[model samples]
Target: MSLRIAAAPPLIVPVEDLLRETGAAADEADIMRRILAEYRTTLLGDRHPLAEFRYRHMARKVVGVGSVGTRAWVILLTGRDDDDPLLQAKEAQESVLERFLEPSAHASHGERLVRGQRLMQASSDIFLGWQSIVWVDGRRRDFYLRQLQDGKGGLDPDVMTARGAALYARACGETLARAHSRSGDRVEIAGYLGSSSAFDDAITSFAEAYAEQNQRDFDALTAALDSGRLPRVPRTVEE
Candidate 1:
């Protein structure tokens, strides 16, 4: 009946252990509790179901390649007997495009991301929120939180046939268009794209160019590794 038992989910680790593994200082445990408490109190509020639940465990999650080096953590909370919920907090840094464009209107990066997600997604997680925490390392980091698993699904490109991949790509394009239209001037965008294969061809050409650039970057990385200019970390698998 204890969620902290040895048979607990593989991703779930003791709160203290999660902090240590994520490189937090010894006093991080207490600071983490205060941060979560404030998150629940100010963001979730007393009316939220999660407000009644207690923080039980945490898991450090690896953000994908696009978000490389950003810290993310999933916290487990338990309410009534065996009733558990997982919430993920992902670090949100300034927009990557900031260097080339105007600064974001939203001061808090986490709030900016949360607002964008709410605008783009058809239906976002009810518990989605943002918070700022002064980490043990003395840096104030922004993070956005949401329910860990939402029923999102994706097809694997590696296992897809050419035709299937084309269909999948079109579907992804449509989805992105819909999301963009919701937050942008749809009429202007539609007029710009037009009803022709020219737009498609242009997109394909750009994709091909991008793939070639990506390959060059990979080759440089490989050369660095081969010449002992870069340290290669062994891939680890956990069970």
Candidate 2:
């Protein structure tokens, strides 16, 4: 079955205005194009249809809470006629998991993210690639590029029935299992899980505790903001 594209609110800012707001220099666009050109040649190949596409515009993309405070931008490229493609180039930093485990072997964090995504997913975006560039501020940053929301879908939990929610959960579990099986020892994992509810119950308990902890963290942050112990910046995004 084919997947549906997820619906999202518009997040466009004028190209020049975005650059100005972000403190990019006048020649930043040219620098970005050079980076894209290198990516096109190395990863996508010069024969790819997108290789001939010319850079058009770009904007600052407001990402979700998980990627909050990270630099993200959407680039527009056009080929012949009205053919346009939107690609997101998001900054990739050292993964949070690295704090607990060994550091990644991949030199570039962007490449690390792209490789992990390609390995875990059944299919990935055709434009999936990574590049590193030194910004106008002289800071080198790593970024992975992907076609924006290509064949992506999302389910709304608020509108789901009990049966639908269960089905969704099952689907999610299956997907996670498939991904893990691809990268891990399936036999070992199966032996550990073994036809028992013990593992499931343990996971349920962990999830419940995690949710309670999340709520407590949120309450603590709210209290701190209200008490002026933490500075609260108003959101500039319009509803």
Candidate 3:
């Protein structure tokens, strides 16, 4: 029997105060709007592929823990063709993770996200780029732009059965090993790992530890929400 169930609405999390603490000044929303307008003109160009698409509207939203609280906007672009999506995402930036890990960081935030995503992902979306904007304070900050959600699919572990999880874990392991092999010198890595069994055990240990940490972080967030520490504002939703 097919069960008809209504999906619960997404829980909105506010991180604007967090952004301000991280280095973004007040009035970040206005700054983001101005930045996106310039991006469409400069980076995208007048006669670009998506130029013909009509922009229905844009809205501000919070996303990602690493870059949480920073300004982000998801633009809805509609095209005459049903298959084409005119959606675009614009994110404000601070220091990138690469800057902490490596001495040489990209000049722009968009470049960092694009380069890192390329390095980690098997494949990436086509429209990804960086842009810089000088705010009213006369300080220039970097922002990255990309398609919101193009051909995105993923399974949630919360709903997965044990059998499903095991199968998914095996598939993930195979995928990771394949990705590592594609990057070259797999024989050396394999030798260092000293048989697949040891490597698998190490990965499993790390995954379990990380999962615990994730639970702790989730609990902290829940506490914060209950205490009303996060910013609460009326938000407009779009589908």
Candidate 4:
């Protein structure tokens, strides 16, 4: 399918049009646009509300410190309503776990992640899909796009009582178990665990230590910046 890029920013246009922009070539965009349309069709079908909206604009967004420098974009879609749906497209990078384990089989890291996540979760973002883009530099980067904060926001931990906290923790454990069962050999895990809390205690201890290490690292970074060991751009943040 053919695609057209908007002449100016903040204008409504087909999202696949981004391929015709600075990132990818026209031919590549044609192929990718079809693929993206197929993905959308698979999730929401031909009559979904999101299918009709034009992508208004895209903006680069900052994510976690760990994900620093990762290419991420947010596209705002506009239709009949004033408050339109938003989608986030995040570039997939190599797994940090690659250091200890075999690399993933999928060529597109974004697809690899989405597949694993879909398998592990009871429900997933219906809009999720992987797109492989070739930049002007001729290097390929994989990205996965999903609806931003769809039906999100719940469980305010700060206000939870002790009973609520315990219930939440139990829920988390059950969810983790389900995810692990999908991702690994559940029978083997059961055999290894064998009604013992030994491994559980070990893992909990490790998690505590890891959290402490993260706090120390964060403190060190703050100290360095304060002492002029590091330089940073000045910005006021509202707490």
Candidate 5:
């Protein structure tokens, strides 16, 4: 089957701009060392259940689009049983609540991500928690911990046909209904929807409108690049 997928979004910062923005003067190796030390000391204290697992190595890689310039580290850990794998992704500190309607940082941003993600996802990895610390520079940052590979998978939208999209949309609606039903009256919702096609039509219209807006934003970014306003970054092959 012929497949048409939308182009990926452009990077806000070009590779050169990213290097300049981060003050390339900062020793990345030294920063990693401090982050790792803080990760173990502040986030995973002596009381942590998984402290027994020995850290094998840390691999440096860039991940995420919105927070690309921030520091992120992926740490690998191994148990006495060679087959067991433990992964911890440490993201640099940024305000967790500022971006959303509900904000919370009582524990830390990392902990909040773990908590919210756990609440939304059907299944979650073990060893998810938040760690916080005051850096040597007096700046505070938070890190969230989780096993890197825990049998996670996602469908490729590019591979989805019209039929697949329709079925997926229905499944998403059912899932959302089921999630909301846990907190509200399902009988009332069923009565409101009343086996009507109106809700589906409304949702479809909204989806199309949002998709158009997304396209507009993408075009604006492209225009910025062409006008020499936005810098392009070499996409990292590794996540």
Candidate 6:
């Protein structure tokens, strides 16, 4: 059976307080409304579930790891009495991977991410879409929108036992296989990966050795820091 994620509890940020606080200096809530208006006929049609939901309010939002200092907002709309649906609109920037690789197909980085996720995953959020807004500085900014699901769970690999680790590895491998199959020729891939315990064993050996080397490197780095060879940089990434 598939898991059913619970809907998030309603967030009641009074519209009056929001507009008053954000009076004239960089209002993301107003920006969200403007962006959503363009998609009224396209995505949120007359018969859609969120069709009747108006953009009633907005609040500044902080996104997760590696995306620090990004401009983001949580938009809320109340339908009828207590029905409040929240959507997150996060600023999109060029992928660090793109710095080493070719540029994205979509001009907007947000659409590029959304398109890639759609191809790689079995399913995606229904509200997944992207738009560009002109900032006060005149430069345009791209943003992707989606509802934040309440049931999303995170992993803790350090706490897992041997059996749990093995299960997680198997599941992760299967997921990667599925994504590869969708993006490439499944028949050719199956043939290449065919009846192969040899390939699996080799890959497992390589991964374990690499992980051991990583541990050694980390230990060396700690020693260097203790000896004052390298100065620590600012917090560049967080998890």
The model with the greatest TM-score is 2
Badly placed stretches (over 4 Å) of model 3 are 1-48, 54-57, 64-66, 81-86, 92-101, 156-159, 178-188, 212-239
Compared with the true structure, all predictions reach lDDT values of 0.79, 0.81, 0.64, 0.73, 0.63, 0.74
Task: Give the CA lDDT, 0 to 100, for residue 163 in model 5.
Answer: 99
Candidates 5 and 6 compared: the better one by TM-score is 6
Whole-model alpha-carbon lDDT for candidate 4: 0.73
User: Which of candidates 4 and 5 is the stronger one according to TM-score?
Assistant: 4
lDDT head-to-head 1 vs 2, winner: 2
Q: Best by lDDT, which number?
A: 2
lDDT of 3 at 130: 63
* Residue 39, candidate 1: C-alpha displacement in angstroms: 2.8
**Comparing 3 and 6 on TM-score, the stronger one:** 6
Stretches of candidate 1 off by over 4 Å are 1-30, 40-46, 59-62, 150-152, 212-239
Which regions of candidate 4 are displaced past 4 Å?
Answer: 1-50, 99-101, 150-162, 214-239
Q: Each candidate's TM vs. the true structure?
A: 0.73, 0.76, 0.58, 0.70, 0.59, 0.69
* Count of backbone collisions within predicted model 4: 0
Model 2 ranges off by over 4 Å: 1-26, 41-46, 211-239
Better of 2 and 6 by lDDT: 2
Task: Return whichever of 1 and 5 wins on TM-score.
Answer: 1
The alpha-carbon deviation from the true structure for residue 98 of candidate 1, after best TM-score superposition, in angstroms, is 2.1
Full candidate order by lDDT, most accurate first: 2, 1, 6, 4, 3, 5
After the best TM-score superposition of candidate 6, give how far the Cα of residue 122 lies from its true spot, in angstroms. 2.0
- What root-mean-square deviation over C-alphas does model 3 reach? 8.5
| lDDT agreement of model 3 with the native | 0.64
lDDT at position 120, candidate 3: 60
TM match of model 1 to true structure: 0.73
RMSD of 6: 8.3
Residue lDDT tens for model 5, 1-239: 33322354432323334445556655444654555555565332457646667655555445668767665546655667777665556664546547775556456778667766666656556566656655434567777766666474567889999999878878877777766675468799889977879987898899899999999999999999999898775443422
Expressed as tens digits, the lDDT of each residue in 1-239 for candidate 3 is 33322453332323354455457565655654565566665342356665566555555565668756665656655677655664445555645454667644577766666666666668755556667866444677666777777475679998999999999888887887877776658789878888558767787899899999999999998888878996444444444
